[model samples]
Target: MADNHLGEFLRARRAALRPDEVGMVAYGVRRVAGLRREEVAVLAGVNADYYARLEQGRERRPSAQVLDALGRALRLDADAQAHLHRLAGTAPALPLGHTTDRVSPALRRLLDGHPGSPAYVVNRTLDVLAANALAETLHSPFEELDNLARMTFLDPAGRLFYTRWNWTAQAVVGHLREAAGHDPDSPRLGELVRTLSAHSADFTRLWNTHTVRGKTQEAKHFLHPDVGPLTLTYLALDVRDSPGQQLVVYQADPTGPDAEALTLLGALTRSAAL
Candidate 1:
């Protein structure tokens, strides 16, 4: 059988949607989960047979207009809609295959410049390419800080480190799904997903959800081993020169106790090196 990612995605999303969510009365006992294929076809303004064909992988090429309609019907967000388009070969593709792990001198300098903030560079597969002292200190609890997904799912410290462990897991899986949509041919990504799936049941469950999202600005909560609770806001910026590379920076409120804790964390790292 062909590796039908598009069909799989469509099936997952369709199964996730509920009748009431789309203002349809779910009459009688339903055998299947979420909306049926015919319901989605009606909502998307497409023929039932055509939609079935699309989901069965018989039809691969979908027009932008049809995709837009389907996106609306499925209640996809901006990122997911783009991902759908990319999967259908309608949108511009992202950088394919393994991205370079090397971080530029300028980028390293930039990371170091943010002395008060914790900053790190990660690729599509959540591999940590490089990190500043603060960033390293912030994630010191992890046995292996190489990959965020591995850290989140495999590391013993992950549950203790992330205050909202479930939310972090969901986000990580969703981001991975988006990455898969971008570079379906990436061996590294495939390996990472396989490893996570084999090891972590939580990762496997979220992976099956087909949630697609990119890392944007978000509030992250952490329980630092040394400093207790720390809540920080992080921003994920794309590296223009390095495709699939994202510079993630975390900041605490300047006047808050979290900032003081961050400073203390930095001091601990510096002291350890002394």
Candidate 2:
């Protein structure tokens, strides 16, 4: 029998893909993205009816061979492929509570070691599990905010912090959507959503968009109260043996106000400790 959460995950992934992007053409009117039932079936070398049944949540269990074929057909990367397996119930399900990754000592050292760079450690949910002095100084905490998603959605300060507020908020929601697939039953995640949705209408709006994105290198702009607007590039590196932990590092853009602001933020951090 198909589980509700499993069906939701499959539906979310199905919607994330598009026809043109997946090398498929409807040749007529279509109601959905990516390959249609027939197209996906053809690509996966399976019967159309079987694929339809699988999509409809009538077939919950698929063999590893079938999942592998479907993954290729979908052009899924390793993380996305794992998400597909979890959705199909081939992988063991986890509790959707607020399961979090512990900040490793080495990771803490890594963040502290990068005193000049704005560095923080985040779990799959984009929770700011910890931050070094530089990151803490750069982004103001709102209502005692530490979580990235919370700040992006709930904090007025964070709204001011993000130069492009709308886009930044949407990106956080999109990132959370991607993380949800990695672990659906985590109560901690459920609580986080409940808190933000209750407080921020914007969060609720973006969450409904159903967008998803993997953690990758990207640029961010922040309007710091102390130093003005600063742009930075960020990248997340996966932590070994930690399924959800990733260390995110941010560096100032070499040109423009970001460079000046970064130097100022660094000085602010050093002076504060003096």
Candidate 3:
């Protein structure tokens, strides 16, 4: 899967451009699709053998400088560049495929207390391990039992939540692929890859792109049944007790109706408990 991802990504990027677009003229009869190995190596300022190794997945880790050069040569956008860094093993990241730690009563209390914020915990497979009232209410589709990637790709309502569903969907799928890289031995991760590959072509395409993303600022768009579509920034917080287990939090703009809605949601949860 990793080899397929890297090869396909390079191939797609190469095909997306006409050689003339990158100032490489169609000099002669080219047999294969996209730039040849040597062409990309020349553009990226690396030896053909080295680039070949990288493309073949022989090279697991490459320097940032080398990756940057490749990014520039390929004219990769920001997300694509980050993906390249991840493939090169340059991102400061958590060990994936490790779903550890019980949600301690204390941790559960914290999520419960943050009633206004859409908060939840994710396992390595990006499964919704647990969620609070606001999270359930806001991400209504995810309230059902499904992994994040599955919901992102397989569910229409889940897919509908994102304003740029295509981009967000790609990222979610890529993140799952990255998890696979971090821990190749995981049976559950393997099963997920198999399921997604069989299920969603979009996921299969993005997965083959060999993209990687660290928890950067992600503003999610959700079409809540009651409050309508909302945009909220997301943060992934690591639980202290569990090294790789992360607590994801969602927050809206300070003065927006979403903020007000969150407050109301919290109150409703409180009233229900009372």
lDDT of 2 by residue, 1-274 (tens): 5245544555555666677777776588767654566777887898988877776777778897998898787676776677677656687754544345678788889889989998887887777888999988887546654688987777668777787888888778867876776666567778999999999988886776555667767788877778877778988887765667788888876767787889988999999999
Q: Which of candidates 1 and 3 reaches a greater TM-score? A: 1
Worst 10 residues of 3 by lDDT: 1-10
Model 3 Cα lDDT, one tens digit per residue, 91-120: 665654334746778878988887778889
Task: Estimate the lDDT of model 3.
Answer: 0.73
Model 1, span 173-217: residue lDDT tens: 989998888888789999998999999999999999899988877
Roughly what TM-score does model 1 have, to 2 decimal places? Answer: 0.97
**Highest lDDT model number:** 1
Pairs of residues clashing in candidate 1: none
Spell out the clash pairs found in candidate 3: 83-212
Angstrom error at residue 60, model 3: 6.5
Best TM-score goes to which candidate? 1
